[model samples]
Target chain A: GAGVSQSPRYKVAKRGQDVALRCDPISGHVSLFWYQQALGQGPEFLTYFQNEAQLDKSGLPSDRFFAERPEGSVSTLKIQRTQQEDSAVYLCASSESGRSYNEQFFGPGTRLTVL
Target chain B: GESVGLHLPTLSVQEGDNSIINCAYSNSASDYFIWYKQESGKGPQFIIDIRSNMDKRQGQRVTVLLNKTVKHLSLQIAATQPGDSAVYFCAERGKGAQKLVFGQGTRLTINP
Candidate 1:
């Protein structure tokens, strides 16, 4: 794909169910980011990955949220024991360089609904 | 107090009219600012970027103006068209990490 791609455009999970969201960044991109967006709010940074390293997880809200990028190309964000507040859109973005200033391309995002 | 838009600020202009969207950031050390457009059901797409060094930067049909003193930013779109209708967001990257703090956003509705 010419741009970033994500999986499970829509998901419905029970309050205690676990869900995993996938992100395939643009080929050769060195920076990958995950953000969580609530209804009518802008995306909030969750984590940042530089290649295969999880450089920043300071934005992760709780222990239930975890993300990994072992190969440096693709990443996964997992949420365990989801709660109603977990219902929001998860957005993935990638940049060519792992620098401080770079243009990021985003995916369609996954809309998660917790019941 | 948390920053949330009580009502989405809207800009309605006729086709071909130039449009300006404004944003106010709180962080003082922000050195990088970016403008993104997000359509319904889609994530934000990078439109243009501006560094704090210069006050103004221009792209194809867009111009970004940054004022560090007042912590204000604005995106100016030239020759607005129906296809340009979307929500615009301004983000600031603070010192250290590249995490962006986005604004409340303004809805641009190009009336044809």
Candidate 2:
């Protein structure tokens, strides 16, 4: 009955600092995804996971962005050397299946502000 | 170089009137389309979705139309209400692709 949840709803960091955001997907979800949304713009895909396997990471902006879903239930997104361009809302979503047609339930998202 | 884009940045309509939001996708290979609604301080919520094989799909108070030949998509809301005010986004998934490409959102304002 619980929806996807993210930790540290808002985060502020100085330039060059490292930050990690957490996401708790719904129970029994097989597919998880991460996205970055800039202000007034649509969300952009970052990565995807299926049962703890990192299947797609093509959308990661650079080497600084890394994600993991070690146990297949919870996922973490890490950003190293935070840059002003990285300031945006990071959203987490999970679906019942790994198929592209399934609807994804999204989390409230973590807003990261780099100064 | 292909992307999903909206025709308008904002749309205002009176309560009880119908509202329409349009989107254009450059990728003809896109096979799945979805519409999402988002409010301030919240994540996107799925409204409805349609596959490329279907031309239209209907949900509670909302309908989605897809024109594969032209790569156009539209969301129609019946009896628009104040609670329907939010930013609407159209997303597409190319055939066999695992990722969704989202379009610029349309801000819907309901004047009650």
Leading candidate by DockQ: 2
TM-score quality measure for candidate 1: 0.94
Model 2 steric clash pairs: none
Give a tens-digit lDDT track for model 2, residues A1-115: 8999999999999999999999999999999999999999999999999999999999999999999999999999999999999999999999999877999999999999999
Task: Write one digit per residue (lDDT tens) for candidate 1, span B27-89.
Answer: 677788899999999999999999889899999999999877877788899999898999888
lDDT of 2: 0.96
lDDT of 1 at A77: 99
Off by over 4 Å in 1: B1-8
Which whole-number lDDT from 0 to 100 does residue B112 have in model 1?
Answer: 80
Clashing pairs in 1: none
Backbone clashes, candidate 2: 0
| lDDT: worst 10-residue window of model 2 chain A | A97-106
Estimated TM-score per prediction? 0.94, 0.99
The lowest-lDDT stretch of 10 consecutive residues in candidate 2 chain B is B92-101
Off by over 4 Å in 2: none
